[model samples]
Target: VCVFAVKVGFQGKEFAESFEVGLALAVGMTPQLLPAITSVVLAAGAKVMSRHQVIVKQLLAIENLGSMTVLCSDKTGTLTEGIIQLHDTLGIEGSPSERVQELAFYNAFFQTGFANPIDRAIRDSREFPTSDIEKLDEIPYDFIRKRLSVRIRRNGDSLLITKGALAHVLECCSTVETADGSLADLGPYREAIDSRFIELSNAGLRVLGLAIRNVDTPHLHKEDETGMTLVGFLVFADPPKADARETIEQLRDLGVGLKVITGDNRAVAESISKRVGIMSPVIVTGTDLRQLSDEALFQRAREADIFAEVEPNQKEQIILALKKGGQIVGYLGDGINDASALHAADVGISVSSAVDVAREAAQVVLLKQDLGILVQGVREGRKTLANTLKYVFFAIAANFGYMFSLAVASVFMPFEPLLAHQILLVNLLADFPAMSLATDSVDPEQIHRPRRWDVGYVVRFMMSFGFASSIFDFMTFGAIYYIFGGDKPELFQTGWFVESTLAGLMILMVIRTQRPFLLSKPGALFLFAVLSITLITIWIPYSPFSEKLGFVTPPPMLMVIALGVTFLYGVGMEIVKALFYRYLAHR
Candidate 1:
């Protein structure tokens, strides 16, 4: 046996060389030591075996993941990748393409780092001004100013390029040109520009305004570049994920609500939401959220699907509010900013390539950073949980039938219904095969539209079936005992005959109803064979051991009575189950 096992171990060397070595060590050990060595080696191998352990761990993780009804994410890395790019530019008013490009170029060159997505986008554009320009001074980007400015000499004329937030740039501009080449007052044009900015932003585009002014040809300084002509606006943002639209639709089918929580402007977030099919009438901003109390925030969070300019702290607050309302929240993130909410979520999922801190906090890490895996993971989780529950249900019901029959026989008869070993054998034969096979059975419909298992449903079904089976088991044993006793009731002993017969009947009942009649083809031939074997075992008295176990050779009249009892018990159970199902349907 050891030599054969060692050969098989060599074939499995790719899986784990250590396992092969351990198996070989066991084969060479002393007889007593061999068993211990084999047991330890097998135990160690079980840990590394992918088949059952992977399924078990994945199922547990997925169950927790699917329970999440709310999700919180950081705006920068989570949504926009903290990178911005230009999509399309609409020159409202009479601003020329040349003017817009020149203003964008100044903003792009003046910004220091390529880290800011907007700056990189502007620098990448092909039409920006390059020739006949000499830089004089610059005012770097600032959080407070929310803008960048630079001074340059072009054709001996001092040009000031000031680019900043749309509202701030509009405020500094005294006048602007319309697209039709007419001069327009900044007041009315400001509203139109703001509206256009919103329109673009909601489509998932980031918008920045650019303005320039002609200053006196003095040695230009960074401070002198403010209060300039509104040159034009620049738009930049990361393109949406290729399958983001489809992924969002899939989530909707699974009854998961999708929301965009971003630090970008509200318009950009709204635009992305519309493109991705997350339509919600209400759009909320971080500034707006700050004004509301916690109670109001919670209510609004449920009602709103688009949030913009949202800070990291606000993400955590939103998750807490959703959870407080009895919703399970799952957070997906890959950034430090998302840490707080991720930690608080029921299940935190991070991509494998995510930051160490984020991965450490998450319960599940996707091998591939794809949203489709979430759907598949949830289905597998549901299947494993259902299979485990099915095993538990049958085990409990079978034990109840066995114990009920034994109790009745002990009270009314001279012999014990079944010995401990016989009872153990019946359970081993019936339960091991049936329950193990059930775990592998597939319900295709369940995979498509899986739902979270309700504990209440399992309890209700088990109790209904278990109670019916127990009653039937008791009646079958009682009828057999009474009938075989004949007119000389004290002389006749048939406890073993009734007990073994009841055990065979239980095996039949369990197998027949394993799958719903509507769902599975009835295996009547197999059931008949089981019943025939049971009959022969009790009546054929060829073996002395059978007689010792209290088997009785019953006459034809007693056989007829046993058959009738089985039929009546089965009919009664079907009627009860049908009525219970009807009540449940109505409720």
Candidate 2:
């Protein structure tokens, strides 16, 4: 609009001035470096994240990481040590039993189902003598049943061993074995089993019930799991990492809420959450979630921080619910049960050692399952996004002012505001500093909270700063005609060229940060790039080669006035920026 209006509005009056004003507006209004700058910043951030032991499968997800408002993390590998150890193997009487350990080993080592940390831990413990044992049939572990059944032939006798969550395993057992190798009906021992579970769980130990039965059939099925004798319990422990609490606190300070979604029972999840500094987090179980309507769960998902005993599919449900409630969610997981959740989250994060399904579904894969590394990734992501926004603010504000100034000057002045080549040179030179913006250091305040694209804020920024810049341009216009003698078109063009380039460069520095420009300095590379570009811009019009570009020597007063205007504009922008931020806050 600026170019077409200026061209048509002036062409009827003066052809030369119309051509100059139209071409200048066209060059000043277009932001040629924006797309290249955005790509460079995102690529640089991805490289930095890789240095912190993360692989970014999707480049654009880096920005999503910075924008993430909620992170749904699984308890086992992310917040905890990711190492499961067999704490104890106890008989039905809650006493350590070698027989129970032997049977547990058979089930753990011979199962055909997918292995997990618990299964690996059991196998890593004492090796049981099993030369006489022959593998037969197996019913693999499933989320619904929460158990694994393995039928084996030992000394020509077909026996089945089952192990899983206490409640589910207990349902399959008809009797309990006493410490004396005798069987008793399960009814009398129910209270004792409950007491033992409470005792172990209070200490934050995960308990799995073990049961056995003699089977006549060669094929094992879920139906054959009934009428078994409860043998013992397998206790496992995975403590929180040493830095887990600090990492959690750091995430909180960065304005990222943490939610733990695990298939573990509520007691264990609550225990780990408290240990990691999540005090009094609202807890929700799979059963509780199932009872709530989708709308109700969406509302509750915002308040609840710990989701326990959730099935594999329920993990995806929780993530979707959180997103539906208006959160940009990031999910971290490392197991088959986590694949769906990872796929459904806004940013899926998994470890390199995660199951193939989970890693494939994730956007980010860490070399180690540690929250510390993930926190570092979040910082890098924020820094990248901040630099990208800096260019946006600089280009929009400057171009807006540039085009408006050209339009206003074309109408009121007798000559063009700036020649076409002059406008392109100034625009390109002033924006060269922003090419190094990816290397600039970010203000701590800038990355303290998640950032998103706010079109309203961008528009307000452009209007406010652009209006101020145009005011400064008019000041230069007055000085050009009144002081430099605008009767000579060459003198008028040269003065405005120096003032526009120098002032544009100074404002670029100001808009890079919300903090007062002096307090938050840019990187060394950025400073050098700006200094080099500023020197080149000033030398262009005064050099012997200036004749070709329609430049003439300006009086020394013109350089002084340009510097004076640039300094005054910088000061005014600082005040304007501070007030702008304050207004935004109050609004």
Tens digits of lDDT, candidate 2, 1-587 = 55546556744555565666576677678777888998899999999999999889998889999999899988887778889999999998878998988999999999877868888999898799788899899999999999999999998789999999999999999999999999999999999899899778767789999999999885677899999999999999998888899999999999999999888888888888888888898999999999999999998899998999888888888889999988999999888888888889999999998889989999999998899998999998899999999999988887788678867887777777677777778887876787999889999998899997889899999888999899988988997789867688888888888888888888888999888888887999899988998888788877889999999887888888988988998998898889888896324
Poorest 10 consecutive residues of model 1 by lDDT?
48-57
lDDT per residue for candidate 1 within 77-119, as digits (tens), equals 4433445566555476523466576667765775553245566
Among the numbered candidates, top lDDT falls to: 2
Clashes of 1: 15
Evaluated at residue 213, the lDDT of candidate 2 is 96
TM per candidate comes to 0.61, 0.96
RMSD of each: 12.9, 1.9
| Candidate models: Cα lDDT each | 0.57, 0.87
